[model samples]
Target: ASITERFEPAISWDQVARLREIWKGAMVTKGPLGAQDVVRAVELGCDGVYLSNHGGRQLDQVAHPLDLLVAARRAVGRKTTILLDSGIRCGADVAIALACGADYCLVGRPYLYGLAAAGQAGVEFVIGMIAEELGRTLQLLGLAGVADLKAAGEGVVRYGGSPASRPGDTGDFGVLQ
Candidate 1:
């Protein structure tokens, strides 16, 4: 049989509920683009919700997970675990995600690229590089560590153009002053 003929594209809420009942391990639902869907997933007994846009590969203009993350976190509160993927290229991205309320961030393509380039060593190198970048970012932000980054919350990130106080300031876009 051809791939399309054998593949089932639809999965209903009932199926998800059933899977939750049968599966004793942690269950996380991926691809939630808004707070409502995040709340719905939690209502359905999901242990976590993974916010992603599939790296913008699935759709032309899907909402970015980072854009939706703050509201999702507000809707779900702090108890339920929230995982974010898509567009996480560096450790600074991870810090931003955590500050915005993701409990954990998932990195895919970078490590995969490393794996393809030079096996385990490449993956290690990429991870180390990311870690070093994150460390530097934290230092620049006057933060001690990841715990401090999470504790700092959204205050650490400033979006869009620079403020009037420092006109023509062309510093980093996301890092707050």
Candidate 2:
């Protein structure tokens, strides 16, 4: 059987193989390029990577890391500590990141305002807000517990990126085609 036929809840090399096949043809580099950059990064001894075009805010228009995250993860294999932190703003986003294969995430702007707004107190407030919002967000999705979040995607996807040919496909933003 093929990789798809071997997918398991525990996830295996077969599952990873399937992902690579689907996304290998999808990786892209800056403004449309080749796949060598990704290969080069790994060969250079980088243990992990984060795919981003500076959160799309810097580029004005670019592919979402969500698409690149999957492709990148598959490119490097499961051992890589792949982390992504662009355009993530909600608890649902957290789920999406993990689903797309982010080992860790980074949220940038939220803390800046808290530091500027009320110093330490403001920062605490922002933390609380994020926690409350994340919990509520997960609760609404029937994921009352964080562990339950493992089964994300529910097969529901919101895709984008011109390089990505599928409906929401945005392939890879900056990666060389």
Candidate 3:
């Protein structure tokens, strides 16, 4: 059977609250995409909210995780730490996620790719490349750290398509609030 089918696929609120009562360390819930679910996780005592689409492996046509970050942040406010994963292959991707409101990004495939390509050296190379790109992105955006990304907001990243791809002659499109 598949991994999803092998285990109990459903979770209950009582189970989450009970587990939180028994655990000493931080508790987090992963793969929740809705703002209401994020808010509910906080109510259930989750220390963090992990936004993911299972790397787009679990379902088709799900919203991009980055696109959901802002709503999740608004739903939970600043009290809960919101994290994101999936489709993050580089440092710039990391920066974009943060600017969109993710407190942290969890990378999986990039590390796995590095490991499969050349072991330790490849892993180190990938890490260094991401760090370098992060630094350059910060400098170019005139920001000092990742925390400053919150202020950069939606203008820092562009979704949809290239500017030239738009057929209109007007330059009056405003940022979505």
Candidate 4:
């Protein structure tokens, strides 16, 4: 409740402009699920926008990070960077985020799982596993590289409708979409 109250006002453009003078390193604003907030961030000269619902730990009924990627991409266009951090468990999820317009996706629980299981070695193992899986996923999707995944677009990542009945839809194309 306290955190919710504190965030009620949201950050102002003036505040970001002021912070830009002091913070020399990269500045990324997170926790927004709307295009307007993203536009504001870009206007303020933010380095990037990290799209997140705090893993759904902050609020309920928040749109999935992948879903937000579409609107964010349209709002920011291709030049501005976009990152996602929510419900991404494996390489497949990473692929979906990228196709949906996310430049990069952040995984949180996976790292924590690695840490809880076996410290640094576990983290290394997890990273290796994800990398291998991502490579395989790309290959299976007939993609040559991460850049190729973007070509898949929303056609590869479906949310909750019947695949065949999706009007003009042909088939699953082997991905979630």
Model number with the top TM-score = 1
Per-residue lDDT over 22-60 for candidate 3, one digit per residue giving the tens place of the 0 to 100 score: 997999998776888888889989999888988888754
Q: Per-candidate TM vs. native? A: 0.85, 0.60, 0.83, 0.81
**Across residues 17-99, which tens digit of lDDT does each residue of candidate 2 receive?**
45555664432222211124444554544445556667677554655666566666666667666666777665556666665
Q: Write the per-residue lDDT of candidate 4 for residues 39-129, one digit (tens) a residue.
A: 8888888888999988888665877666567777888898788989888788887777787788888888997899899999989888878
* Residue pairs in collision within model 3: none
Candidate with best lDDT: 1
User: How does model 2 score by TM-score?
Assistant: 0.60
What's the C-alpha lDDT at position 75 in model 2? 66
- Model 2 residue-pair collision total: 16
Model 1 score (lDDT): 0.81
Ranking by TM-score: 1, 3, 4, 2
Can you tell me which runs of candidate 1 are displaced by over 4 Å?
1-6, 160-176
The lDDT per prediction is: 0.81, 0.56, 0.76, 0.77
The digit string of per-residue lDDT tens for model 1 on 1-177 reads 876689777777788889999999999998876899889888989999998888888754987788788888889898789999888898778777887788999898999999999999999999998889888888888999989988888767654322211444455555555
lDDT of 4 at 40: 86
Q: Enumerate residue pairs that collide in model 4.
A: 156-177, 157-177, 158-177
